[model samples]
Target: MSKFDKALTAIEETVNGALLLSATLLLFINVILRYVFTSSTTWAEEAIRYAIVWVTFFGASLCARNKMHVGIDIFIQMAPPLIKKCLLAFAQLTAAFFTAFITYFGWVSTELVIETAQKSPAMLMPMWIVYISMPLGSALMTIRFVAAAVAILRDKTTGAEVKNEDAVDISRL
Candidate 1:
């Protein structure tokens, strides 16, 4: 893999690992407290909720990286080569544009959260930290979408199938 690809993969993996560990620890603690101490900390639930939000954002980015996002590929598979190429380009462009739009609004949302000094009710943590995930994830997915689009264009122009890092069988989708 290229260095860029490798770096992106590493980042995704790190985020995934951290989020998983946080979720696991929070849940474990919650369970232990409930069963053993008969008392639960309010912060634990908020922690889990924040972890979940992070997971959702990063997981979406990971899905983009892996090309595992939901799609109606059956129709694309049946189309003629040129049509398939067009369809692929259109899809990639749409994704890129949408992500870019979301990234802009996400930044605005993050700023609003920060400026307002929003805080989680239970944990009392800055809400901007959670809101920041929106722009970050959208930006990453935007990059991934652009890469995929370039690969598609290269394939169409050179008649070479670009090997995708996350390529897999349709069954897995």
Candidate 2:
């Protein structure tokens, strides 16, 4: 990865972690206050909801980078090597196209939300800030898919390596 890509990934990870931590802490504190002192943070639920939305979008990009999206592997697992490569490539292409589609539509939706000037109820945050995550995450996912496709094509990687990190024993499932 280039320095820029590395930095972008680091930022994503850090932000994801921070959002999760803050949400967890806030929710915990709110719960304790409510039970112990009959007090609650009005914004806690809303903040956690927004944080979850951001986490989902950001996590989608991270999942794309790692090629961890769930996919049916039975056919590819049984196919010949060349066919497996072709199938995997086609799958990646389809994924890229879908992510690009999401990116375009997401941006359009974000623009519309911005024009409406709507805000969240509790935080009064511009709705665009939350909606913006869709396009950003979709764009990142698109880039990751395209890059994976390029690498698989240029290096002639087998699809088997795609799930190498997820070495689960099916008997347990």
Candidate 3:
């Protein structure tokens, strides 16, 4: 993989790993406290919720990186080669546009939350911290999608197939 690819992969893995670790630790602590002390802290719930949001956002980017997102390919399989390429290009463009939209709005929403000084009810954590994940994740996903689209276009122009490591195996599916 190129350096850029490695850097992106590393960032994704780090985010995913941190979120997973946080979720696991918080849940474990919550369980232990509830079972052993017969009391639970509300902060644990908030922590877990935020961790879940982070996981989801980063996970979506991971999905884009892997090309594992849901799509209908039945018609593409039957279409002429040139038509299929056009259709795929269109699909990628649509994805890029939507992701960009989300990123823009997410950043705005996060800033609004920050400016409003919103806090989580249970943990008293700043709402912007959680909301910030929205834009951050969408940005990551956008980057990944852009890279994939570029690769696809390059492959098409060069008469080479775009190979996705995580492409679904129909027989297994």
TM-score of each: 0.87, 0.88, 0.88
Prediction RMSDs, each to the true structure:
3.6, 2.9, 2.8
Question: Candidate 2 has which clashing residue pairs, if any?
Answer: none
Instruction: Please list the C-alpha lDDT of all candidates, in the order they appear.
Output: 0.81, 0.84, 0.81
Model 2 lowest lDDT segment of ten? 162-171
What is the per-residue lDDT of model 2 for residues 59-171, given as tens digits with 9 covering 90 to 100?
A: 98889888889987667666766677777778888899999999999999999999999999998989999999899988888888887777777654554454434645454
| lDDT comparing candidate 1 with the true structure | 0.81
Question: Which is the leading candidate under lDDT?
Answer: 2
Q: Of models 1 and 2, which has the larger TM-score?
A: 2
Winner by TM-score: 2
Give lDDT for model 2.
0.84
Residue 11 in model 3: shift from native, Å?
1.2
lDDT of 2 at 127: 94
Model 1 error, position 4 (Å): 1.6
lDDT tens digits, residue span 1-173, model 3 = 48988898888889889889988988998999999999988789888889899889989999888887787875555566666666666667678789889999999999999889999998888999999888888888888888877766766353225333444546566
Q: What's the TM for model 2?
A: 0.88
